[model samples]
Target: MESIYIQTPLGIAKIEGDKQGIATLSLVEDVALSNEIPSCLQEAVSQLNEYFSGERNAFDLHLNPQGTDFQKKVWKSLEEIPFGKTRTYLEQAKILGDVKAIRAVAAANGKNPLWIVLPCHRVIGSDGSLTGYAGGLWRKKWLLEHENPMRQQSLF
Candidate 1:
């Protein structure tokens, strides 16, 4: 798999994938991946920039994130979450047809390698508070605020 790191207002992010699709996008404190940016990565970088700039609401990149079957199921569920909307882990578990698997569902969410593209940041605690996120709670909060800004919140 090929990888390239890009700088964003949130922080430096490491994007890794190949012709098949983008697999991961992890926030990093530094750009340590010393490699040429591939054409696929350029598209991702542009979309990510548009996302951060609030000019784009949805991503159009082909993604082939790596993970176990269960994790893939969870990530796919996450994709169904509408932009600017949030869902609880329990709700996601219920959608997966097993309310008892809440913990496992949350675990899969935590293990989601694709980050924003997979929309794991859209999941929240049952009480509507931000919860676990591999990219850090601050980034999660920022993303939520970015997606659902104060004006948007007021509409509801």
Candidate 2:
């Protein structure tokens, strides 16, 4: 597996993968930025840069996140979530055909390895509050606002 570290507004992003496609992309606090991106991860780096710059809303790179069957199902469902939108854990469970699986759904979401490519950050608390995010809540908020910048409504 090849890896490359790039600096983002949030922090350094470590991207790892190869011919099988990208297996992981996560933020790190301490990693030297690579002056050159690996051939296998170039596209991912480009898309991620575009995302941070607000030039891209969706990712289209090949992904190969490793996990169990249930986890894979949950991750796949996360991808279906539209850009600039949020879904509650309960809603995600329902979409998976098991509303009672909210806990499991949320757990799987937390374990998602591909980060932004899989869009686990789109999930929010039932009351519309930001919740658990491995990358940290602040990053989650930034991602959400980056996708859908809230506009001020002027009083008429």
Candidate 3:
């Protein structure tokens, strides 16, 4: 698999993938941006840039996240969550047809390898709270706000 590092508003992002598809993308600390982006990762780099800039609300790059069958199922379901929307872990479990699997669904989300592409940040706690996130709660909060920024109210 090919890999590249790029600077993002949040931090440095490490992306790994190949001609087949993008396998992983994650945030890392203290890493230099890649000097050159190979052809295989060019589209991903472009899409990621657009996403951070708010010009794009959805990802269109090929993805090949590595995971087990159950995890794959969970990830696929995550994709159904539209941009600018959030789902609680309990809601996700219910969507998966097993309301009792909230923790398991959250675990799978924690293990999601494709980062923003998988939209794991869209999941929250049942009480409208931000919960466990591999990228840290602050990053998760930033992403949630980024997707649906509140509009200012004006009074004349």
Considering every candidate listed, which one attains the maximal lDDT?
3
Task: Give lDDT tens digits, candidate 1, residues 35-99.
Answer: 57788788998899899899987899999987888889999999899888999999999999999
Off by over 4 Å in 1: 32-36, 152-156
Q: Candidate 3, clashing residue pairs?
A: none
Off by over 4 Å in 3: 153-156
Q: Estimate each model's TM-score.
A: 0.90, 0.94, 0.95
Which of the predicted structures, 1 or 2, would earn the higher lDDT when compared with the native? 2
**By lDDT: ranked, best first:** 3, 2, 1
Task: State which candidate, 1 or 2, has the greater TM-score.
Answer: 2
Per-residue lDDT of 1-156 in model 2, one digit per residue for the tens? 999998889888899999999999988876688988889999999999999887998899999989999999999999899998999999999999999999999999999999899999999999999998999999998888888856445689
Clashes of each: 0, 0, 0
**lDDT of predicted model 2:** 0.92
Candidate 2 similarity to native, TM-score: 0.94
- Each model's lDDT comes to 0.87, 0.92, 0.93
Between prediction 1 and prediction 3, the one with superior TM-score is 3
Q: State each model's C-alpha RMSD to the native.
A: 3.3, 2.5, 2.0
